[model samples]
Target chain A: MRGGTAVSIAYQTLRLSDLPGLRAAIRSGDYVKHTAGLGAGHLQTNLAILPEAYALDFMRYCQRNPKPCPLVGVSDTGDPMMRTLGRDIDIRTDVPAYNIYLDGKLADSVTDITDIWRDDMVAFALGCSFTFERALEEAGVPQWHIDHDTTVPMFRSNIETVPAGPFGGKMVVSMRMIAPERIDEVREISRRFPLAHGAPVHIGDPEGLGIADLSRPDWGDPAEIEPGKTPVFWACGVTPQVAIERAGVPLCITHKPGHMLVTDISETAEVPVLNPKHH
Target chain B: MRGGTAVSIAYQTLRLSDLPGLRAAIRSGDYVKHTAGLGAGHLQTNLAILPEAYALDFMRYCQRNPKPCPLVGVSDTGDPMMRTLGRDIDIRTDVPAYNIYLDGKLADSVTDITDIWRDDMVAFALGCSFTFERALEEAGVPQWHIDHDTTVPMFRSNIETVPAGPFGGKMVVSMRMIAPERIDEVREISRRFPLAHGAPVHIGDPEGLGIADLSRPDWGDPAEIEPGKTPVFWACGVTPQVAIERAGVPLCITHKPGHMLVTDISETAEVPVLNPKHH
Candidate 1:
């Protein structure tokens, strides 16, 4: 939004107060659309709901691979309320869109998942990259997705995540082109959001992560690499979803890509530990 | 151990490999005493086993006050195997000694807790101070405890820990007297072991943490401060036990102080961030 680029899509204008009402609108079977620019300045989350049996392993998986699965909040067993992430956030009815996966296959896409909600289900809210992406823009980094009116390019990488039970798969990463001189600035800014995918994993070549070409990504649109810029890769939140799919669980529910669950917590709750004191 | 003065205890007489054999001896009801200096270069942990209902609150407490209660490993409900801490750790009988607490009272002391283990209980292993103490000795910061054949002096400080649920109390700290010149070296060495109370919370004076007299410690034997030495305090692991005692839980079990669970993980495993490049 800071860059002087021509606007293509009708950008949804929203205020800080619009969040709870927008969530309410989504809860009552209204406003079932992509939540890209809606509810500005509030933290949005990637959702993963599974049975209590898989909860421990999934939690360990997230702990082992924090960059891709930075956990924001965990729900108590058989409870839908996520107290840490938001106030009165019902996981069953909060998100604008939900995707149901059955035995590693997409079963259906729906607006509300309350009818199929079970007692043993537990929801995990993971921090998404959008929070840090906004931080990057504020710090004066040029993002191609904002300028081109397309989703950020994400690719399936060959970097395997640490295994915990059935949850083990190659990490997926999203790429953004940044000016070479701004590389340190970008790293310093993004590393603050450990809840989001903190810092760039790879700096230069896409082939380092086993990608054959930059034009063809596993998800999202192709990114334009500008002159005097380098491609910076960040561990994407999609990696956990991909791992969940690979686990072949009976039923797994997640938010539809780009249609995130808006939370009441601020994006800047805890100050970043740059050269972390470690205590 | 590498200092000028002669000591009652012979330093470096123990080897790292002796830990497993010692633990085996303890499991078979043989080495039923304090575990100090038994395992040379390995990590030892303080134990806290509680019911499933209280696990979440305690976890939040540890998350809030990581300096005092740095969680090394956590066990699943009804599971005794602490897979993350070591290769073969059965939480019920690993430690040489155990103290059973019932509703804020000391119910009994035992060698093994397997007979009293319940199906709904969880075990947590918190990092102990021994790791940093070893690092301090290696960095040439002499401690009075090893020289005098006694435990490090501990005190209940007025510094209150961040509260979570029912777990809220003033932090307890362990004091070690070091030469004023070596204080920076002590901080540099101890900061590496974040799990083990990482850097000194207060250095140079006991009165800063609200202790009126240095010679009168709340716990452990007080030692004489040599000329030009200052009293340094590190957040003690005993603070969590104090909180648990005050919480008045129906049943709780903890390691008798100095009788910790010796882990196979090396002292260097205390590093929080293992860069993927190194992995």
Candidate 2:
């Protein structure tokens, strides 16, 4: 039980009580690793930390293009604690890994962003496909990537996102191979989770979204498309990261691909990231 | 045209092409009046401006209590131009009127905020009930407001809004008298405009939402519950103003009641205020 088997046991038996300790361990120098299946049933999010100057436009970008960037939590300017997401979650160090970008370029990767944290910085937590992936598995929808032990294939599309100030770029989509019979099930299940890239954007023909070949993806490993199966594409969270890169902002930070911040919010509940009910 | 009645004609016959001129007229001090039917069929929005320090919380406040504050536009911090709603519209002067609040108290009313504008201020445009009121009229649901030419009846409800940061207060509701047969028709019509305080929150029984009597209201005019008519209550845009008053923020600004910023967006065809199709 050294590799995949160990991961299975660690994830299958994971409980809510074990999350705090696990997150604390990650925050320290102990468990710096990918958070793929660590806390099942809890929501995991893609992180983007940017200067206050870019916050409003980025928010507008999200508001205008919610499918790719369904905002889940927004931290106060200069504040790191995402009080709405979890208790005592220090964004600067809680994530398993951080990807540092300088002038819209990937400059370095690190386990913590404590030294880089600034008072003018604001953080955004966006819903990731992981939430819906979990749902797909529960609903008995077969995913070729998980079956073949590869990452979900993603492609850059020609679809231009509604521009907001300096943030504008083509939408990026992730592809999954599903059987013909299970397509409706996937659609039904995904629509219920709007926070998670809800529903498939396209059902078939990779060329429809400008994908030349499913085997050659711009990002992530390509999965097999079995006979009688159709490829489903969903709006990917990476679209913003790409836009951020193209904008050439002076400084930005995001969660490293596959390394996410697991939140205490239950994946099954319709929890509001902003909690506007009492206002 | 002596009072609002005489002025109503100037707006009722006004065409969409005149919006830019109307906004310009307001900006140049030539017009200091309420914006009602000036841009007929176009959307009019309630405005709220806050400093960056309180923006994230207030954004959450609006997100949580969307019915009252169905966010139509949010300006980037320090930028007064509302890029999404209108290209030429400037937040500083486009609105016909503004009420300034200091420490939760009314400070002054102004026609333009240009003199007091700050680089860190953020502007928010919330959907006004005017759009849905128009829809109800089109659906043949007679509104006491349009018939009597009075402000719709508004009440402070027993329902407490979900609190976010320092913003939390009782929910406010606007009531309209609808014929019994038109209740569902009104609901169907209003439901189409989520940004316009979508549908009725309460259909009847004023006591259910903590109202003592129909004749008395926390804000706006009293109502006459005509025979075979039921009082339909919708979430009022006044909720945020109530919350702002309770929060006691150092400063806040809201559209003077009934005055709004009319936009190029049409009342019927504009995408759902928070619709994913456009976002």
Candidate 3:
């Protein structure tokens, strides 16, 4: 992990919060990189665009699985403007990368999706760990993957998500290594952002989560546990993708893993993860 | 406010925690009264059953207007059972009475909806003031109308709810006369049940809420202020009814104004009213 990469990502995050300016870069194809460490104080979301036919069921699925799918904003059918998420935000161009799906299979990875935007499409934005990951960085906790310019270590967990309509799958989790002394501080900061997956689902012992090895991850890089540090896991946004693929809708699109939409909503915004029955 | 009504209502509430016994009484033709004080500690929800076509937009409407529409449970399309709300809960016969709407007009009022149930209908449960009003009672605060056996005074306010598709209308508020000394305690208690309209939207003024006189309310009975009491208002669940009526779908069904469904969920349950942007 390099010290300079963290500083560079930090600079982009701080500067881009002048959101319009940052979005211009992404919109104009001047900045095409993954939005891993960008967009600091504002909420960053995992995007999913589904047909109107599948929208209602998917919403129920999200409500049932708030830990992995903390919904931040939903767009009206056929509407490209995510007005609730940000001022003058166009869902088709705001996100840097998109995974286009045809009949539930990934067909293409593109920078801009305006060409394929349809009249019956509905876009939904779910909260990503990017918000809380920045919180950890601000609170003096180290992020191994961000510094290394690598993806966070994510794993497929044994826990099953509550099924809705045609969506159901096992949960996916992201792991971070935290020193024992800083564990309390990390938990305190993270739990406050319920939209950002809240507290750790598992603090230590990967085997308990049914992961056979820390070295082998289902997705992303393997984050090694430093001496005296425990492995902490948070529900990952990828869990929804798994359900979507299994549901196999004819046309579905999502942010290519690691790329996210930077929402105008701030981290301090007080939306709690809703009770399942209350959702 | 009377002495014996409060005592009798309290007695039914306590005896009903034996839920099966309570529901059996409601399920059969035996108990057909309003559910106001009957389910003290459990979650009591305002019910709305909509055709599948209108379900998505109505959901967005609820998500957009959390103070007035704190969504508690959503039934799967065409499903009569609200699996998430309570065990063995059948929507058709559970609520004491239902308002049947055809083309936005009240067509009929009935105790059970099974005879009219269809394959493309969805039922949604929104948190009602019944839960928080019970809290006010438990906290030693006085509810003028409840104690007097009258409907809580509700008024239409000038605040416009964020509109979704065909659902957009002004918010409705419920007013209560609170002794100035207990105002803080009432606010503190109500805010904790975000699912229960959170805190008061206005305190100590009727004119400011655009009411010409507190003596006349738009819905429910008028609550008069006692010598040292102040008028406190919370956003009412009826706000959604206004939107639903304006949308005027071909078929819409809701619980009768004062009648509600007593859910298996408890009042102490921790569902927060979501941030509008984050919903």
Candidate 4:
């Protein structure tokens, strides 16, 4: 909404507070831009849709490694509606846009996946760092990426996720520059949002997590590190995308990067790891 | 070890602090008694092992309904070793006794399940009430059944669990008589250990949970209600067993009632819903 090009369809001007209106817009192919700054207080999820065959192991991968893939909700096998996440939330057309992954590689990007929706597929909703970033802003500790107007820088770390089926790989982490004095406050507030990757897995040293450079992140745009601040990392939702890509399932679908599915759930609602800590 | 005869065999005087010795005693059929006070501060677990065919649904069932099925650990799809739970913990011989369920009914009870263990089976260790009951005792709220020297009273509640695949049913609750003034403290402490069926689902009236009479529990022995004390119910680990029984999986294995698999995990180590809130 802030920087991306918004291609509005046949609809009135959409307000940020209107959840149903926003979803309806997304469903109707009205707003296909990134879901940043929209539905400000509500939960925004990183989406993953896969065949039922891979769901069990994939879920095991999630349960074993929660910080990266804090599963918020899982749709019933072959079911399009995610009754658990919110009201009338259809997984197929609810997101702003979809990324079609064929054998774990990006094949096509589309507005809606209604044409490719299959009976054997299951959808997973994971907690996004945006929830905690909002919490941070409310708490008066603004994040680096938001201030710089860039995507949260992500990297593949030396930390290996607990393997389950074919979906195990190095954990992908998002970097944030935290002032030395405010690190504890950030950790305490973040601890309250485990669904939002909880507290940082690694703080201070990037080499401890085996990343060679801070400016060259594996994914997302790299940001500057202020003189007194240290780089902090949280397990990223993109970790699962990395794993999914490595797993190479015949058919997998996800929200195009930055494009997310916003839900009716409030940010303070615990997303309920109270899991999106093992859902 | 106290009331139920601990048939101590060839092993020389086993100390309660020794985990491997205890497991060895159980594995060798030396100590085949109910594991109530055996491990003391160490973690005890309720178990369910199903072929990989049903593992995903069962795990999802655990994820959806965490209180009743607080998943402490899950083994790899075909692995007998619960490396995630503890060091060198083998599911086949660790539990004191195993209850084999076939087509939703009790088929056999055995001291060892090595012969029936399948290559495709997955074992799930759930936090037993003993973990929280130990916590409660430390908090100075002695439970009625423990004080009275009887099994915890259990009943089927009208509250249905969140269904996942073939594993949905009414929640089974275990009741403990708490003094009216201490309910809040009990609830807080219970919340801290979400792994051990955190917090009570119902309090005071038995009818609220569709429990007909406190004197007649559906499972386990009924303990007398202390006058002026309130009846509080916690979601029981037995809930999953009920679901498993109803689901009628071709091959299912669980710990015999009262007999549990004791692990090396400490009671205070969080089990770690920080899960047993979502995991």
Clash pairs detected, candidate 4: A70-A276, A71-A276, B272-B275, B273-B276, B273-B277
- Per-residue lDDT of model 2, residues A103-214, tens digit only: 9999999999999999999899998998898888878787777766567889998677877779989999999888888899998788667668777777898887778888
Off by over 4 Å in 1: A2-18, A28-30, A37-40, A271-279, B1-11, B15-72, B75-123, B126-279
Worst 10 residues of 2 chain B by lDDT: B270-279
Model 3 agreement with the true structure over B207-262: per-residue lDDT tens digits: 77788888899999877667788999898999988888898889999999877888
Tens-digit per-residue lDDT, B177-217, candidate 1: 88888888888788767678778888876777789988888
User: Once superposed on the true structure, which residue ranges of model 3 sit more than 4 Å away at CA?
Assistant: A1-17, A134-150, A177-192, A199-205, A226-231, A271-279, B1-15, B133-150, B177-191, B199-208, B226-232, B270-279
Q: How does the DockQ of candidate 2 come out? A: 0.15
RMSD of candidate 4 to the truth, in angstroms, is 4.1
lDDT of 3 by residue, A207-244 (tens): 88899998888999877667888998898999999899
Better of 3 and 4 by TM-score: 4
Error of 3 at B7 (Å): 8.4
Please give the CA lDDT of all the candidate structures.
0.79, 0.79, 0.80, 0.81
Top lDDT hit: 4
Consecutive 10-residue window with the lowest summed lDDT within model 3 chain B: B270-279
The TM-score values for the models, in the order shown, are: 0.67, 0.71, 0.85, 0.89
What does the interface RMSD come to for each candidate? Answer: 6.6, 5.2, 9.7, 7.5
The alpha-carbon RMSD values of the candidates against the true structure, listed in the order shown, are 6.8, 6.0, 5.2, 4.1
Per-residue lDDT of A93 in model 2: 90
* Chain A TM-score of prediction number 4: 0.93
